[model samples]
Target: MIRIQHLSLMRGTKPLFEDADLTLNPGERIGLIGANGAGKSTLFALLRSELHADGGDVDFPSAWRVAHVAQETPALERSALDYAIDGDATLRRLQVELEEAEAHPDHAAQGHRIGELHAALADADAYTVRSRAETLLTGLGFSQQQMNRPVSSFSGGWRMRLNLAQALMCPSDLLLLDEPTNHLDLDAILWLEDWLKRYPGTLVVISHDRDFLDGVVNVIVHIDDRKLKRYSGNYSSFERQRAAQMVLTQAMIEKQTRERAHLQSFIDRFKAKATKARQAQSRMKALARMEETAPLRAAAEFSFEFREPASAPNPLLVLEAVNAGYRVEDEATGASTERTIVKHINFSLQTGQRIGLLGVNGAGKSTLIKTIATELDPLSGVARFGKGLVIGYFAQHQVEMLRHDESPLWHLAKLAPDVREQDLRNFLGSFNFPGEMATSSIAPFSGGEKARLALALIVWQRPNLLLLDEPTNHLDLETREALTDALAQFDGTLVLVSHDRHLLRATTDTFLIVADGKLMPFDGDLDDYRDWLFKTRLSPAKETQAAATANAAPSAPQVDRREQKRIEAEERQRLSTLKKPIESRIKKLEERMGKLQARKAEIDAKLAEPAIYESANKDELKTLIAEQGACGRELEEVEMAWLEQQEALEQIA
Candidate 1:
């Protein structure tokens, strides 16, 4: 268990949390939620002891093991396996001892040393460690070839997987993870959600992924206004409770206001009467003692209005085998090459239809969006916009177009041009920019703020059609919900490419899955499209060797079948006679392994202590090392036997 007491954290002059308390039980999975900069990450960092709070303490059992996965993967050159195995100090020591024993098997005291090494190894389950590492890597979508590859070769997203795999492999008592699903593709995210559901330890995760939170976590802890609120269930349940509480709060505030007004009228009408004056005074005191209602702040508001062009028509844009890609040229050599990222994507945007594009990472979702938005042309095929359909394009990289020196207000005015300065500020304020924030330069804004600014600029024009590419990237929970709500209520047609499941489910009634070298239109939600993708693109056919092996033995002839049936009956009888003995042996091995592991942990704790430095510097150190070495050897032998027995059981099946 972990407890946070009277926690107060201040960033610069702003107090993030004041007198806040939070707790986590042994097996509870908590979803840490809040608006942007509401201390979700700060609270996590404090719990992990990475950041010190202004005042208060984080309490945890001294024996508990904790692991935290940061938002960004560390820049390291280690192999993936090395990175993961380093997470467990005990396991690493065991490996070191085993490797030493293997290297010097023919030494002077070989027999005695090998015996000790075998014991220590078995206790550590060193035999299964490599297999477990491989399983975890494969489960995270990495191929066998990549397990030994240097971590630096992988992209940032894959590096995140390495970080996540490391944290998960550690057998910690508590896990602190922030945005574990941020860079993961849909399949990887789903796999993680499933893994977290079965995780044995306590979990505290700060994430904006709604689907993940709903499926994995059992509780939601919300931090707001420097106060903490705990909910008993998932994000959906939390939202329902919050909305119901808001309604009740509003009703109570209204009732209090009416009563206060009535008391004021009574005081005015009967001030001359002493009895009535005393009664009025009592009413006034009651009103004064009542705590003012803490009204919930309205979530950020977003609305897109597209200005319909009334002029010329012939479709707004057209593409005919118009190949578009960036050319890379070596200035010294004067050599250039064009790499075609996307090709033969034939699509059309009509006057009234909105299209939602779907694809895995690097599946040309952005490229398709760019082509349709007229930022790039298709390699082969015609992409034509309908007549009088003016497009307000919001690319995933639109924030890059902003000038660093220009404030958001100034940027908005420069982009829209037609809107008055006052009107532009009003529009910007809707996306949570107000007062000094509106006047702040684009360089100072966070990623989410920059995204909101880009969105505000696009909508100010109010074109007949709106194209949004990954619009919810870097947004917090509240801002994302607001953006989804706004998109759902938009009157103009919209083409969106996003991994936001909630937004896609709510806004997209149709899906265009880009797979098999083309865009295929489907009429349904993401789940339906996923099912289609699995059958068509994701799944590979069974291996020819496995298929052949499965059919190696053809169905037996009549005489062979009779003989086989007789043999099966005799085997069944023999197995029935031996079942009790086998079961008892398996149970005994498990109990013995458990006791050895307990003893191993005791020895590990003693070896890790600083007492060796103060006393028994050399001889005691060698003895402890030998004892650890013995434990490692035993652990390996026991695990190998267990694996053999398990395999035998499977073979019997």
Candidate 2:
């Protein structure tokens, strides 16, 4: 539906595209991938006709509708549903005409106008538009009630989603999205991916989400050094193809370099020979005609050596009866209260298992991860670190802590202490910070750059236990895959909170979910979780959207002394009602932990018997050891719950 012919685009002095040609056909899902500022978004703009190319033609089919969703949204006062439903202005206008025609048949132009209005309304499917609009809105996470709420009340992230809904609902033959998944939580992102996959039209999306790209897109278009390269499959396939291509390209360059060197050496020796003068001259011309092959940029590989610190074999982390949350008070009445975000989450980890933590945003996933990593005492429970375990944390906010005065090179020098200069550059280059980019101070680095640098730092540390929260944010598909591969190879225990479905599935075998103020297990793939969400949360008979958003409820308003007392009394009564269930869950988790611990101890004793390893009946020992290890990990998880439970019990007391 859209094509770029001999297109060239420039931003200031830099040429982003040079005689680059590309095409997007109906129903094609194309993922635009490249380094930052490599003109991925610029190319989208040119295709959408929002930006003019410096040269060449952008051929688009006649009457083709195009829609673009930008990174930032504008001010909108309409409700999210209204904003989405208004995707088709022509349809809306047609509806208005029909309404006018129905109400004012006696007007001067009634007969002719009514005929035209009838045609427009029929063409627009005006009768079924409301139901269609509701489906689009609700699928995009807006509740039925939210259809009338002011969009201005929603945060920028939600506004972006509303904008996306608008784009999707439009009469577009092709859709262009720039970093569309940046602000979405995992659930909303999965919803969009599914929508796009089943969408009848074409889509070209720019996203840092690797899983989304792999799941929805069938083609990959990479823009690099003013050229467009196409791959035939998803991101993972594209990666393998790219690697193979790079190898072939490097070999071609190497062969050409060798031939040129040999020719030059011969020319150098035979320049004055009368018999070889003609040959030397011809070789010189050939050398002049040979196009200079581009050198392969080095990949970033952390070359720093690390020594795993000596640590005990006990659980690397422990949480006992923890209560997590914040303090809240009714301002009007000055009635203070402690709000529990989640209570009675207990877990412990040894040196081997990789655990994935999953939850919807605001479900207290980060709070639990942070409380463990930073060694903060649980609001009511105890958290203890195992003996000698060296912890490395990569929080979402960790990138902001980099010192401004230091360049990527200097940061590596200080952090790794002994990394060679060339090795440091190569490492930074792999993360796409090649050459001078590595020397630039961290102060001016973009969000993606900071994230890459933080990842490099964490990888370089090689700690025995790594705690990573959203480490895949701002990463390209290739880098995220690389990280997953590296993590799979890592011997250390990993506890990570991530929204990247690909990363979670690749690196972790166990899942812990935080929801409803409790810890639960999710024994399925990311797609399975998504399916469950739509079934449970977005079922046809689900509550209206507006009701749900409103139910999150605003804090109590200001009140006089008597009102304050009344509010306090109500809060106390509500807490009393909730206290029983919270207490019950804590007790159950603790009881489970005790039983697992007993099983673990009995297996451990059997494994330690002198003849266990040498016995001809040795298979029994292997099974016992495996069972003991499994029981040990389960016990740790239970302890984490026990801690959370104890905290909840104290709060109720």
Query: Which candidate number has the best TM-score?
Result: 1
Give the range of the ten consecutive residues with the poorest summed lDDT in model 1. Answer: 536-545
| Residue 83, candidate 2: alpha-carbon lDDT | 72
Model 2 regions lying over 4 Å from their true place: 95-119, 125-134, 137-149, 292-313, 320-323, 341-343, 370-443, 453-465, 478-482, 489-492, 538-653
Local distance difference test, candidate 2:
0.74
Which candidate wins on lDDT? 2
Q: State the lDDT of candidate 2 residue by residue for 54-125, as single tens digits.
A: 898888787778887745666777666667768877888887877787689487668788788878778877
Give the clash count for each candidate. Answer: 27, 20
TM-score for all models, in order of appearance? 0.71, 0.71
lDDT of 1 by residue, 46-155 (tens): 76778998898888888888897745666678888878767666888776776787688576656677678778778767777776666566556666568888888888
